[model samples]
Target: MGKSEAQTLLEKADKKANSSGGWFSSSTTKYEEAGDMYQQAGNAFKIDKLFKEAGDAFAREAECREKCKEVNEAANAWWNASKAYKRGYPDLAVQALSQTITALTRAGRFRQAADREKEIAQIHLQETNDLRKACESFERAADWYAQEDATATANACFKDAADLHADLEEYAIAIERYEQVADHSLTSNLTKYSVKDYWLKAGLCALALDVVTAKRNMGKYASQDVTFPSTREAKFINALVEACETGDVEAFTGAVVEFDQVTKLDNWKTNMLLKIKRGIQTESIL
Candidate 1:
């Protein structure tokens, strides 16, 4: 019954939207009615668990609303479409959310756009397995949030982007992002304590490039935050850099093991350490 009703409403909406013969006959009313019909069709389809149909109906509604200059309403309809598509069509979901972001941006709702950016980023990360897209979305989200004066949220998004870049082995980009986060953290007393963590992450990425680069960046990290040099994280970074500099695989492994015993290394850290170890071994063979 619900599916039949939804299909009926969709047909009516399509006819209303497609009816021609305007010439100043005021087609705005027809568009507004068509939008209403589409919204009803979407709701009915959703009640019948026809997600794709629901999403399609909502997208049509959004288009009609946009035609009527109802920007916020159009954005809401696009958001609904994204949610409906998310259960089955992840790529379509991302596309719908992109529409939402565009509408919201045109409406000057930067914060909401930022929220949608993060949502789409997560879908890319967990559903699409597209880390590059996820990283770019996160960076875009950070820009939106920063423009909205949401400093902490922006920094967190940057950190997430940096982590994704690291996961993709794009160490230079990851290091830059980590440094951006650390630079932002340095300006706030509440966040100053976490600066060392970002610095440590940046150092690890630099170490992946080379020991000279790692040592140079670590120097910058210490200069940025005076207390960083005294932290155990800094000591570990120095030790790892030296191990890499000397082409000592055992020393690298020993340093990682010692660090893990203290701070409980995460998967990202472990993976990066493994890469560093391989580089050392490769160099030793040469």
Candidate 2:
């Protein structure tokens, strides 16, 4: 088949780039010109539905800008590459985003790198539907934000990972991440009030596993936060733990009902507790 217009343009751009001192030693204007040609080729490829080629061209444009020390422009070009790859090649999209993140970080743009990390986590969660990968990515993003002293943002990312782990029924991992959220929140005056809620979530996740784990976590929470005091939430968790220890389905239901009457359980918590109740009943039968 004859070369398509996009392919022809890309070949011409490559030849021009090679003749003009190549990628490594090209003048800034020469690199810019090459980058523009590559970008044009990428757009033409997109119109032809040559998605992988489009992505490659955009990535090449990004590389040229990166060599020129145009960090922001390179980051944008990488982002475009990711967008181009998203439709037919999700893994490539992720790779492109990773490059963007590395470029931004190398330029000492920590905040932007943190944001890009979060975007990568979101892509793992929403596009790839890989909960474990999403959790891992979120944890990395949280660490980056924490390094920058963005405690609230870090806590939020940790919470998101914890929630995803909970959905995966990885209760222990969920509990650990939730505790991290609580621990971080307690250290910041602005987020102190939310600590109890995170601890409550951690306690609930532990309760889903076993009463002993829940109790152990309760003690740990008390030790970690000296200000931890008994509240209705604490009482509710304690009651559930006691009921779970005894395999008392009735008592478990009663405790959940009582708590629901006051501070209503969300749908997810309600479903998890109901499943636990069923498990207890089944065990009693056996």
Candidate 3:
């Protein structure tokens, strides 16, 4: 009902946690008691609506559990600490969540660890606007997810990483990520239909480099997916490549317009296409 009640619980917790028992009580028993005391204090703080104190209490409990080698329990405590701190202390929340991820990884809970990594990435993206940190977390999560055979989720993370890399103008890294996802997508029947989209994105990133690189990548993509060579997307890419090689800006514009007539290009695709168009024009001027 009040802070006084929670404060009383905290005092009792401190008393219990600090006491040294006789020979009958071992160090393990003492530490476990300390952990239980800390947990009770955390819950009491929560009941009194003292969120930061509650989070601090849970973090203490997590530390105690970690010393006792109760890894999973420590991970759970760390997660609780993160959740309690998320709104008011976002940086602390990310740190606590990072601890949770590390603990879960130590427990060999790869999927759970990957999930927490994604949460950290989202926190960076939505709460902090730290694009570089977000990209790194997503990339790490994707690798872990792939190791756990979560192909779909891994691809989603990879795509997010790729998008961020492209936004940062790291085109070579973006191309690698897009192609990696496409290569994996081709192995799953459910995802095979989406490989074309991934390859198209990879091709766009390559186009940012040069027409020769784009043509080489197109050939590689076609070899991986036989039907890819016959698709309208492939033809459209080919037309753009020829336009770039010959320095024909009108042909490039016509190719984009023709493709957009039947299939709507989203803002990203449209922007990338325009960027490549500009590169070709600059080359022609030289």
Candidate 4:
């Protein structure tokens, strides 16, 4: 069959599959067939030096196969998306990601979905400065786990949104959200207390807000109690103190770099770092 006939056939198949509403059990066969047709069209397009068309066909095939839970097929779609992204077709990349997200979401693997969503959000933030939209995407992602009452995951989403907001200098909203996570009442979840990892996140957020507020207040609220921050908190505090003491942007940037290297924090590490970050010369618990 000619490439035009094959493309037409594939398009019809895709419309049928879409009408089925992604109910994979009923449409898997149709998707599998459609995917094969798309592949043939994609190959034809590639042979004709139509990389863009080839990518679109491959991406569509991947999306169809992904809905059918064909992991290899889904991965291939992402590979095609990468090719498209490399070819400077961000729209194709976005399409590929959309399919990937659908697969991840349907599989009930929310963490992966959240990660992908963040990746897309980052791209949007970088490419278009659509921070508000990025924030919305993050919120949707957080809501996914939040619906499951996954406090840790939800807190992380909130934290990311707060950071973006901070970047926009929306400090008050950022601080409030940070506090909501940092001061999350685990009074019900005492099991997390013995587990220093959990509270470390809380402590980090608190320390950051305190420091941010201090800077905003020109040291009016600067307290010495920023002791024992989580390892993550320690980095920021260490950076701030070093920045103040040495007046080195490099050292200061390193200290306040936001990503955390430590997954958990020891109580001692958390406390000590928090104190120092808050301008306390020592951990003299008051």
Candidate 5:
């Protein structure tokens, strides 16, 4: 049987990789060169639209680099495999990214792992539009950042996950994350002033759940942040909560209008509040 083109390329790559005193030799330079050959073969396979073959070649390159203790290079190779897989096989791409994250984390590259996690989140968000997967990826990134003591980045990732959950109407999760952001903010003098805003957002998420839950959450937040002063945002949230508790549609509309006249709700907030109002109206009809 004739050797196929891909098989021939793989054989050549293997030959080059094993040339320097075997695959486990301590010669970083030789392994790097071998990795380059494998990468070239992978790229060729990718151009030929043989995604699985390309992914396999890139995985081999990553393994070679890992054996050489070139952790960063190995991670990059894995990431490249992910990109190649992304073109035709999203599930494979996700698997490749997971491998890259594991490699990076094993190398104690927390920041890089976090970055890769963010990429996974983007893949989930943009490619698959899988909100649950996207949220989980972002949460994983936040966890990695927290491991590295990157508080600001971690908090940002948490906020991103929270917003995605809120968009999916996972209000309970959103509330938890919003409170986390607020708590983290309060821990830093520079961000302390912004805590109230997050708390308000959390309160809004709670309000989306039920009036009783919202009231309980409001009390919890108030107790958590004793320094949280009276603000228009707080007032608006309180009014909304009260209206919801009473199931007073007219009062809810009035409160929203009054708040808008004073501070003007953004489109997202307006939409969210409108949804709550619509729910109240529907309940009244029922």
Candidate 6:
């Protein structure tokens, strides 16, 4: 064979020799020959120290090293740390995660090592129940990923912060996050149970009933509801029981007005009105 073709064959053989243990055996250390080849390559590249070439060689060597006990410990340590963080142990989790990051760095996954560092910070801020700090960390994470134009990852962090804030009953913050979710227009992609849509409809039904029954702050309620009323709004009906019992003058006039307003928004007015009459009759019995 020609010199270049012979060299290509050697490289392929070198690659094949180094990749041992089929990826499933943690204790299988039978790839010493492959590991030696990797070490030779790394040393050869180290002489030049061209950053790209060194990095590539390091990656290949790291991959060539079988699933040694140290690598397993590193992965396990990180996994346990993640579990601990989830269970509310920030200090311990960060310590373990730090070790994992070190191990991964040594394994030549520099970027992943950096990501784990950020993850450690996030756990301390969020999983430790520090919402403010968590928000900061999440923003940092979003910024880091955004700088790389990783919109999906950035949004995921934002979404996590939003959910965390919501869990803490920070509705305003939650609303902001919800707005971010809307910004992605994920609704177009989602075809699941649609709990949000259901809740929106329920909210509209409740608001309409509140206005027709009490009439206090009805205009503001109407205005707000008008802008963002739900799809199931026309399918919902208010029984108007309290209004009937109290002989609310507001209900008598306001009910028809709101009903007309709701009807104008949809063609399902008759179905809604019938449902309301049925609801009223049910209330009459109770």
Estimate TM-scores for all models.
Answer: 0.93, 0.80, 0.85, 0.47, 0.78, 0.33
Poorest lDDT segment (10 consecutive residues) of candidate 4: 216-225
Model 5: per-residue Cα lDDT over 124-162, one tens digit each: 888889999999999999998998999999999999899
Instruction: Candidate 5: list runs displaced more than 4 Å.
Output: 1-33, 41-57, 67-70, 83-90, 223-229, 257-271
Best by TM-score: 1
- Report residue 114 deviation for candidate 5 (angstroms): 1.4
- Backbone clash total for model 1 is 0
The predicted structure with the larger lDDT, 2 or 4, is 2
- Listed per model in order, the count of residue pairs whose N, CA or C atoms clash below 3 Å is 0, 0, 0, 12, 0, 1
Better of 2 and 6 by lDDT: 2
User: Which parts of model 3 have CA positions greater than 4 angstroms off?
Assistant: 1-7, 21-24, 44-50, 246-262, 277-286
- Please identify model 4 stretches exceeding 4 Å from their true place: 1-31, 37-51, 62-83, 99-109, 146-156, 184-286
What do the candidate models score in CA lDDT, each in turn?
Answer: 0.92, 0.85, 0.87, 0.58, 0.85, 0.48
lDDT of 3 at 93: 85
Question: How far off is residue 249 in model 6, in Å?
Answer: 20
Give candidate 3's error at residue 90 in angstroms: 2.5
Model 3, residue 259: what's the lDDT?
93
The residue-by-residue lDDT of candidate 2 on 1-286, one tens digit each, is 8989899889877875677564565487777878888999999999998889999999999988876788888998898898889887888999999999988888888877888888889888888899888888898889889889888898899899998888889999989898878877777788888888788888888877887888988888788776675777778888888888898888998999898998888877887787678778888999
> In order, what is each prediction's RMSD in angstroms?
2.1, 3.8, 2.9, 10.6, 4.5, 15.9
TM-score of 3: 0.85
Model 4, clash count?
12
Clashing pairs in 2: none
